[model samples]
Target: MKISRWLVAVIVLMSVSMTASAEYLETKVNFSERLSSSAETLVVLVPADTQELSLSGWSNETAAQINRAMQVREFTGAAKQQLEVIAPMGLSVDRLVLVGVGTPSDLTRIEAEEIGAALANHVNSTKAATVHVDTSLVSDVAENGRISASIAHGVDLRNYRFDRFKSEPEPRPSQSYEWLVVSNSAAEAYYADLQGLANGVFLARELVNLPGSTGYPAAFAEMARAALEPLGIEVTILGPEQVRELGMGSLYGVSQGSQHKAHLLVAHWKGSDDQPIALVGKGNTFDTGGYNLKTSSASILAMTTDKAGAAAVVGTVAALAAERAPINVVAVAPLSHNLISGEAQLPGDVVTAGDGSTIEVANTDAEGRLILADGIWYAREHFNPRVIADIATLTGAKVGALGTEYSAIFSEQEDIIRTLRTAGENTSELVWQLPLGPYRNVTSSRIADRRNTGSPGAQAGALFLQHFAGDTPWVHIDMAGNALIPSASGIHPEGATGYGVRLLTEWVKIYSAE
Candidate 1:
């Protein structure tokens, strides 16, 4: 997951060459050019003036192609009112695409991107060997470069297919894109950072899409160790005995039901000797809702994705290492599977945590916070990190509050909250801060030191986990909503979303800059 700076540099270099080689064609009003004039598929930049059907130049093409291009124009034109339209002139290609670039001076990076993405989608469907996106109307070099990068990012991420287990796999198709940017120099300089971001996103998707059976605790740890250790990252995996030695009774209690032993994995990337930024993840490899159990088949079917938070942490740390960002980062992943068995910890049982705090188990289904508690305690007590953030599919209440669109964040630190919110905005993986204080009342128990669940209708379960984080300036991310996708969007497919990786990476990037 962590990328070395060296790898990032290499990827950037390749991107620059690729973008430069992709030619950009310019067309004036009333000009008709053959789509297959060049080896690459043509990209027509449609200005907003041409969005409406005028029939200035037309005829002899299938109505379906014209309609599809019109749909693209309508969709892109509404968003960017000044966009220009592009289409193939002759029958050399299967289809022609209309890319809309709004007004020249008023054009934004996002608008330019809409054109590029539209072009990519057009080429992908046509099975074209190459795509030529014309960007002659735009004058700003920086904006052009950003648009190219965004287009590439969208196309690459959206095209991802998880066909690993498919018996009848489709043959790999050969296709390439040629981006015609106004300024070649600007594109070259901006390509590296853009590619690094794309790489990070791709890595996150891969980690999240892996099946739970193949992504077990030990297997996950091994994957981390193999990918990171060679890149100067220090990797450590603590077995059951080691976890018990540290008094992680809450974590052990959850693992008692499953055959697979628990594992606490630590991956450290010391880009600086300064105080480390700590990230803890709850790794419930498979959650059958413990003794409470899941009622519906859907709930049980998707329980394997409970480890999504841990997967995000692993992927983020790997990207950081791979990018070689100059900041000290450490991740703690507490892995376990919640199943039913004679040895499983029963409800109402009180268990001691790593910090000697006892928790009353009101619901075995609330196991995420238990393991996360130990992980947070371990991070603080052992690493003494400057700031700690723990992510987990901690509560269904979070999903009830935010739906599947955003994550719910609970933190005592206002500055951290602000920074995280900004990062979320940039990445589109938004986080809405919720009240953890209200949940504290429910977590306070009479018999044990604390209870996982508070009052009967406790609304914010993310805050309940904050109680065990101590004074580590911790933030709890309830990823119950953001971990997977029920539908596809932008650059993400339906399945594991890998939501937090980009947000966390952006946050770390800002911290390193500071």
Candidate 2:
């Protein structure tokens, strides 16, 4: 039955012809010094300190009416707060949207992005055909068009929708926008780089949202090639034979039961002559937890998201390459499936990694660390990177430790940890540092060099991966809690959050700058 299913999947994949590009709402944005009187919706930015709606951007009569309404509605222009008026008494536009900019301190790039996201959600909900944003009043606080570009970037992030597999996808309303900015602000130039980042995020979300039937290891490699190679990225796919030749027994053992062959996908971008940073991701295309098995329905359904870390690696590289960042980086993804089959690795099986480390499979369900062991080893051996950061949805203990608000980061290097935290804060992909060395005792093994499973899941997983890092400055990010969300909120719509793309992209940019 599984073989027939695999054949059907192959036929379906081969027959389904479509460009492998990421799907996102392409909101037409234009920057102008002149504000248009005719618009389906007029979005006005107001500062919290500016009481009575006192501003030179609008007519006195219009301002007076809005101020009266603000008093009646008690709209103080708080951050992420808005006041909407329909068919305003003096406005030419059909509707008026009063969005708050909070205080001077709140007028930042991040705040601008959030405001943009909030504005996009409102505009999308209203299905406005054309919208005009008046940003003249914000020039004092917003510098160099950063706020304007960030707002647009947030809109792009919030506007993402993955409906490719929908038999009859719901039609989305189309809208165009114009940003009325201060003269010579160069908002368009600033937005160009942000657009690239949005593309990368969309790609990651699309990969994660894809159903298991269509997103196996081989298919993922092909998709990565199709999406990245044209952008000047070098993509290499190591098949089962090549994987075994590299002695990636630990990575290979996890896929022994699957009909779809495993793959070690390598993506290299040589943007500079500096030593590259290595990013290793655990990619379990569809994990059934081998013989241990995920008994609950929710646990089984969530298995499709096990490959999210790999998706982020692909996304980050794509973002950096598209922006033409001046930094060299390499991505290593170990892709496989842990399914129950006669050939699947048993709980007691001992496997040898590419780096010649022996691991005892104390729990068959702990397969992410097993694959990551080889991936990290391969990256350090082949790429000779200055730093190695491995990301994975490795353990449920991470969710318990940090919940869904932050990913658990484990690293002995203070510089890497601090840099990652700053990047996370800047991008809103938050991370919290966890203990690394104290948990090494849990990985001790009686029969092998180490054991895959131990007490305190998150730390054990991190410690297990640290052994393979081999003196390289490494940070292990267990993003099991934040990779996928239950519903749409903030900048994300729903399903896959694409948690690490923006965070990692920012990290690369910061690292490159240093």
Candidate 3:
């Protein structure tokens, strides 16, 4: 057989291009005391209130060019604002990026992170293989390398991209980063802790961003076990038979229509002897709305991210365990798929949750609460924990109520509410408290103890789950709109935000300290 030279060349190019997007961007971060001037790219942090650029050591021509560029761009050094001078004459570095840190006194750890993320986004577009960031000018200095570590963590977070399944005309070539920063060993140690958090967030985002065909209930459970068990956490997965035997008919009903069986993944991390904090997540891998099928194209397309809450719970466990936090925590995720089949539960079907509370399936679209009903009940019954927090992408009303800026939080406990708000602020995964009392009676049903859904938006879903939470200090986080972003942001690209993992992990840290 004879082949033309053009055909062989095409084959080689096709093979290389096909495998280009298989790997993710790998970055190696290093910290040192000295700032290197001879580099491919150099990033300098400038405070907003500063009147002059720090060009004391630079050459006369290079400094003039930088000043001219800054003036033309009108760079005021506002927080996260950037001005780039490429290939300045007489300078060893190829690219010089002046990043604004706002006011020296007002710069915060969160702002530092945003700066890092913005920088990562800036560099991700270009082919800057090695970059150097000078953070010595930032006035905010604290122990455990808070500022530097935060910036490093932000860079790692924004560097993530989930384009694994895009095999069309070949995805973008993977870019590796070698991040060199001016700092000490303290920053390195602190970033190790933050690295744990970044790992968990990546895992959560990957899980949620996964397609429904590969992310079914049992597969999701196995992935969770693979991620958590090696970190010294106890991972237990209950199949459909075990779930049915445990009186989790409400959860079982949601999966009856799908070929994939429902699963209950319980992950426990014992860092201390104190009472554990139970996290229950609604793990609906794909919600087709069951008998009441989703009519909207957009709604059906976004159903794959319905497992964001479960992914967050699993990620939180990974984060805590990896960091070796001094807190006892247990994660309970009810995994299922709400698909249409002959055996699917219909409207008005009544099923018993794990806590013996009967629920009427008023709307098959409201399946997240059904699974959480069993999950929350299982967490409370078995662990008898100090507090129970349930997170889910449960309702569309939450999007209408709070929009995408914040997740809706519902709880009667003032202390828990305050703690959650603080954690949200710390992590930038903001939460707004909604009235829990008004929706308590909305889930009333004539046939069963309560209906799956009711009027007044997200609160009703929370109330139905509350029946299973019982008297435990519980907080229901309705992360409907916040789980997935419509477009790429500074911190996260356009996809699953991995919303609750950082919030829950920060909350655990603060609560355990108290």
> Model 2's lDDT to the true fold?
0.83
Error of 2 at 419 (Å): 0.7
Tens digits of lDDT, candidate 3, 1-514: 2334543443343223212212233666767766543557888877776666655468878877887888888888888889999897777777899988777566676788888888888877777777777766664445225667777788877877776666663434233433334447677778888887877887788789878867888878877776677778899999999999999999999999998879999999999999999999889999999888899999899998999999999999988988899899999999998998889889989998887878899999999999999999999999999999999998889999888889899999988999999999988889999988755589999999999878886878988888788889899999997888888787787898888999999998887787
By TM-score, the best candidate is 2
Q: Runs in model 1 with CA error above 4 Å? A: 1-37, 44-87, 90-94, 101-120, 171-174, 182-185, 456-460, 511-514
Model 2, range 1-514, lDDT digits (tens) per residue?
1334554453343222112222466467777888654688988877675677655546788878888889888888777678898987666678899988776455766787888888988998886789988877676524536677888788877878777667998765367788888753578778878877887887788778777767888877777776778779999999988999999999999999888757899999899999999999888899888999899998889888999999999889988888889899999999987887888899999999999879899988999999999999999999999999999998899988788888899999998999999999998889999987666589999999999988888989998999899989999999996777888787888889887999999998887677
Over 1-514, each residue of candidate 1 has an lDDT whose tens digit, in order, gives 2444543443343233222211111111111122224534555454555433322245545444554557664544333333222345543444445555555546554444444445444555565675565555444666666655565555655555555556996643346556667666666455555444544455455545656665666666665565556557798999888899889998989988777768899988898888999989888888887898888998878876788788778767766776677889998999887888998888899999998989999889888888888888889988999889988877777777788778888788887898888888777778898776544466777889888885432243555666666777888887886776777565665677776777888887775565
Estimated TM-score for each candidate: 0.81, 0.93, 0.91
| Higher-scoring candidate on lDDT, 1 or 3 | 3
Q: Output the better candidate (2/3) by TM-score.
A: 2
Off by over 4 Å in 2: 1-22, 35-37, 52-60, 104-106, 140-144, 183-185
Query: Where is model 1 poorest over a 10-residue stretch in terms of lDDT?
Result: 22-31
CA RMSD of each candidate after superposition: 7.4, 3.5, 6.4
